[model samples]
Target: MPKKVVAETERRRRRPTRQGTVLSEKLIVQTALRMLREHGSAGLTARRLGAALGADPSTLYRYFAGLDGLTRAIGEELMGRALDSWTPTGTWRADLRSLGLAIHASYLAHPQAALLTASRVTGRPREIEVDETILGILRDAGFDDIDAVGTYHAFIDLALAFAALDAGALAINDDVREADEDMWTSTYAHLPPETHPHITATAHLLADRMNHSAYPAVLDTLLNSAEARLAGREG
Candidate 1:
């Protein structure tokens, strides 16, 4: 009986065992996006990701080349997710608004990934689609082909630059609001009244206008500038 039990145990140990399959590429991206939402850029490393996914660090390389590639994949995933809900309304203004806000919200929601990927020019598939949409919006908004391309060049560049800056600020633990508070309360508190009279006097008002309000206001400013330049060229 003891010999039979020992033989059975050996057979069980030798039998082909199935542990759960390692995570897939899409699964890794999804989990990484979640981790990015919870922790900032410093939290996202291959080792950390591997730990979170219950796999060895090297397992991730089968899916993503490295953290930079992972970051790019995250960016593309963000764009893909954002575009899933985004449909063009045929009106250029509406289309532009949707595209800009969608990209902003998507990146900001994963601020860590945003900080890593926002400034990068991925030229990924979804990014090309985004560029196409921007050009289409410009053309729809009464721009000729040349005007469309030029306006697209300006609009996308400005929007992406702003997105990167804003996301970078927002990613670092309320640094955006905290820094503004410091600037107003601490930095401006001791400045001499005579030489810096303007800032000292108007600092209170400046404080109120710099919140989420800046997004729409900056967008308006960019659109206005682009429109004015188009007018100049046409004139």
Candidate 2:
């Protein structure tokens, strides 16, 4: 069947279930995200999703092509949320910083979803919009095409990479996460200064800071580099 025909047919089939739950792509994605948060990535199977929605597992195919397609939708939803929260200021440095933090915080807020979707390249609407917005910000700030593209690429990759990295830390079981966090204070902070002089010297700082996500600091560094490049170009 033609893709559009299939989509139309699917739309026609949308209806309320016995529980009065209306089935739609948005509902499914939202339900899936909730499941992921409560049960982690491994728990978002079709059967479980259908059970949560009070629908047949097969009914999901009407809205999404398959599990992969549904997963992409989930990814796009997160991106859409991040984009929605941001209002760009004309100041490139502040705008990029705000955007970067919003994206990072959005992912961190849903660590389970971030673990599954942060590394994905959905190439969907929100993802495309974010790319365009970043490029526009850089270009408007006097970056040439090459510079804008390069900066966009780096900025996005850094944001997502840090999201995935931090989400991994957050998505671990509570007990495991506590153990990991405790290790900074218990193990690293108590290492022998004779052999681990550098670590011992800064153990207090490390104990204070290591448990936190480094995304904010790293973001500032990247933005600084981009600003320097732009300044050099104008000079």
Candidate 3:
């Protein structure tokens, strides 16, 4: 065996597919992601995954213990992609904002996967690294342990919550998604001023703004609230 193949074999137990194609964890996760994108959440099954990979369904057990384990692995892959190219700039608030956007974008890229795993706690390597990075940023910015933990919890949960919400919207089929988008302009904007004065008065503004994700604004608010709390502690 080539040294590379030997290393892979040592790193993970492998089995050749029915076509004699070798399999690894990375390949499986990537295949699973593609399946999710092509078929939506319902399309990802061990048997289907096996057929896609040209491997026996039983072969998957050696890699992921079960479907739940595989789901977490997929979630970890998203986390890995989010942080892969990002480097902190030492400004805690700005760094956090960047991180939040990156995470949200990654989840949005695979909305079905995000819908499945956004709120999950994988405890996998990439997920652990992300958690540590957030906590480290807060600690470096002078948050005490308690405040750091609390703020980190709030920050991550808020980001994932928005990711789930936005991804769910995106995951809807095209016609429904378009209709939902159009509702802001068609339905909300055209409400009669006499019966619904408030909505009618601001209908134009609401139509203009209602189509975008509120994650950025919500993230800013959370960061600003944390900053206020930290400043109060110092004074």
Candidate 4:
């Protein structure tokens, strides 16, 4: 038998921990997500997770090789939720917009989980499926191979970047986030116009816009560029 297969077989053969909780991979991943929400990224240690699940920490290895393996599973879980909730509209531009928004919303929904997993290269199932779907969307819309890949790269990165950025804001305590938001009004809006003319001029706009996620506007800009490119090709 192959070493990898043999190792997996042995890991699965281990019985439940002393607590006798019948554990599964899904349960572990769910517990991890909850723990991340309640305690933040640093609090998601094996010991704490095991305690939450009422199993020994070592028992988790039966389902995942280690915490890193578990982290990748958590990332996959979030991606799966994003893909599952989205229904493509068949029009490529509109579909792409919907898909990007779905992903952004999913990560923001689980801010702490997004903070830990959004930037990871999971190369897992849901991630692969998302990549394939985006590539397919661009290719089917008449983009050549290079253009499709370029757009796919930018689209996925932009969504995940916003997810991470916005999730960071959400992951912070309400006090800090409120204070940061108020800074645009309290600090920038009141800036001395003589010394900071540009900011002073735009302070109201900044206060209105800066507190909101730029994901939707930026996503539209990206899609608009792609649309113009397609129009150019047709012309």
TM-scores of the models, in the order given: 0.76, 0.94, 0.93, 0.91
Q: Cα miss at 4, model 4 (Å)?
A: 7.0
Using TM-score, rank the candidates from best to worst. 2, 3, 4, 1
In the range 104-195, model 1's lDDT, one tens digit per residue, is: 77777776777777777766788778887788678767778887887677666666666777776776667656877577667765678889
Backbone clash total for model 3 is: 0
Q: Name the top TM-score candidate.
A: 2
| Candidate 2 residue lDDT tens string, 1-235 | 2123156344644568767877778889999999999999899998999899888887777777778888998989988899999998799999999999999988888999998888899988888998899999999899999999998889999999999999998888889999999998899988999999999999999989988888889889999999999999999
Global CA lDDT computed for model 4 = 0.88
When 1 and 2 are scored with TM-score, the better candidate is 2
Residue 161, candidate 4: C-alpha displacement in angstroms: 0.8
How accurate locally, in lDDT, is each candidate?
A: 0.71, 0.88, 0.88, 0.88
Clashes (candidate 1): 0
The RMSD of every model to the true structure, in order and in angstroms, is 9.7, 2.0, 4.3, 2.9
- Cα lDDT for residue 58, model 4? 73
lDDT of candidate 4 over 24-84, digit per residue (tens):
7777899899999999989999899989888777777767767888899999999899899
